[model samples]
Target: MSRPDRTHFAPLLRVIHWTMALLVLAMLFIGVGMVSTTGPAYVSLLALHRPLGIAILLLALVRLAIRLGTGAPPLPDDLPKPQKLAAKGSHGLLYAAMIGMPLIGWAMLSAADDRVSLSPSLALPAIMPHDLMLYWWLRQAHTVIGVAFFLLILLHLAAALMHGLIRRDGVWQSMTFGKIPGKRD
Candidate 1:
């Protein structure tokens, strides 16, 4: 009923954060499932994967817009410059990966243009022609970019834990409970 505490994230931001987090995790699963399986299994999972990838692409764009318009809270004054730099680098990579992965996938599909059947009844059209060259290239790019994104996720988690448990700061609070610290004093 009331606004989120200043030290905390607004409800909208929290929804975006958690929703994005879950979507990213699902994307990872869909990706892994697609590769680990073949034939009918891969095809079925991929049907879900393709549409979801498109949706995530849209969501990421919206999230970025919101993030730009609403500046993130400032870092604790005591956080060292180097750590701050690392934080920035990691977050930037997260954003880049979010945008890059979907673009590459769409490009590859567009180039393939083959009727890649996600299921027996539902065939998802490829975005491109079936050029072996383009397919291989985008596939490689996707893999490499995905790895980078994976590592960034780990670093993001580590940073959150560090702030929540060790630093005892309100950084985690902002994202989780939707509040910041030091305001009560």
Candidate 2:
């Protein structure tokens, strides 16, 4: 595979980034809907949720591999040390959340002796033993992690806007479609 251009992400990475962004956003909303309702809509939301979570997990793994192989565009040279550290740390947390949340949800279901049905003819094997106490704890952890993930996303968005809008740095444009203004190479 071709390496990404110095000023922009690889095409595949950009595509997957946007796709997973939509998927993660939807998953968050579906999760909230699943927990906040008891009607038939809850069942529908769950059906959407299980498969989407698995999809996110799969995509995240692929994305991480690509990132490790290809790497990302460098941050602006003049960016402060603290901001640069925050950028790296936040990215690490986002990746962790991307990989962790679905696994936690799967394990939570497993502990409850529940099946994670991906389709009528397919399901995931349980990764945790059936234990009500464990299920309760896992469920709580899932909620907390979900909330944290949402906040992380907000922080990420803010940072991106700062790069694109306030700073007019190429950082945001690296992951996006347009050229990085004033960048020669």
Candidate 3:
């Protein structure tokens, strides 16, 4: 038998989820775009990209705080223990990646002596001393971690689709549509 969708998510949670989704997707694409170019052409793009990444990092921090403070909707009674555990683990990994990726990116830029400014010609203080080896390592770290994040996203999407398709649940609804009331067991 099929199950029902619960108006599970709070409005704020939905907003945070989608906002982060858009920003993260942009970051993923821009990370690729940055490495794909050479010369001074995409230097400006990297400039924009770095600051925007930082902005996303800040926002992620805020979202993380809110998530910790508020309770998320619990899984339906029908969910098995292993599936529930997987859901919890996937979310934890997602949050860690969300926080870690941009931060490592920031550290990556900081290691390269890239002090970004909001506008052209303005300057900010560099956080770390510029070392070629450190910059190279951090760049590689950022690339590897970004790819991991992409993989995690695939798993996340698969689980969400599973809730909608196989489980006949509204896991997406909570985050997608406004909260649907949880079904009484």
Candidate 2, residue 2: the lDDT equals 27
Itemize residue pairs with steric clashes in candidate 2.
Answer: none
The collision pairs in model 3 are 6-180, 7-179, 7-180, 7-181
Work out candidate 3's RMSD over C-alphas. Answer: 4.4
Top-lDDT candidate index:
2
Rank candidates, lDDT, best first.
2, 1, 3
Q: Report model 2's TM-score to 2 decimal places.
A: 0.95
Encode model 3's per-residue lDDT on 10-116: one tens digit a residue. Answer: 56767878888888888788778877889574776687777777778788888888776665766777889998888888888888888888777767677887766
Candidate 1 residue-wise lDDT at 24: 87
Question: What is the TM-score of candidate 3?
Answer: 0.83
Off by over 4 Å in 2: 1-5
Model 2 residue 116 lDDT score: 95
Would you give me the overall lDDT of model 3? 0.76
TM-score of each: 0.84, 0.95, 0.83
Q: How many backbone overlaps does candidate 2 show?
A: 0
lDDT of 1 by residue, 40-131 (tens): 87977777877777778888898888777665766677999999888877888888888889888887776666554445687555666778
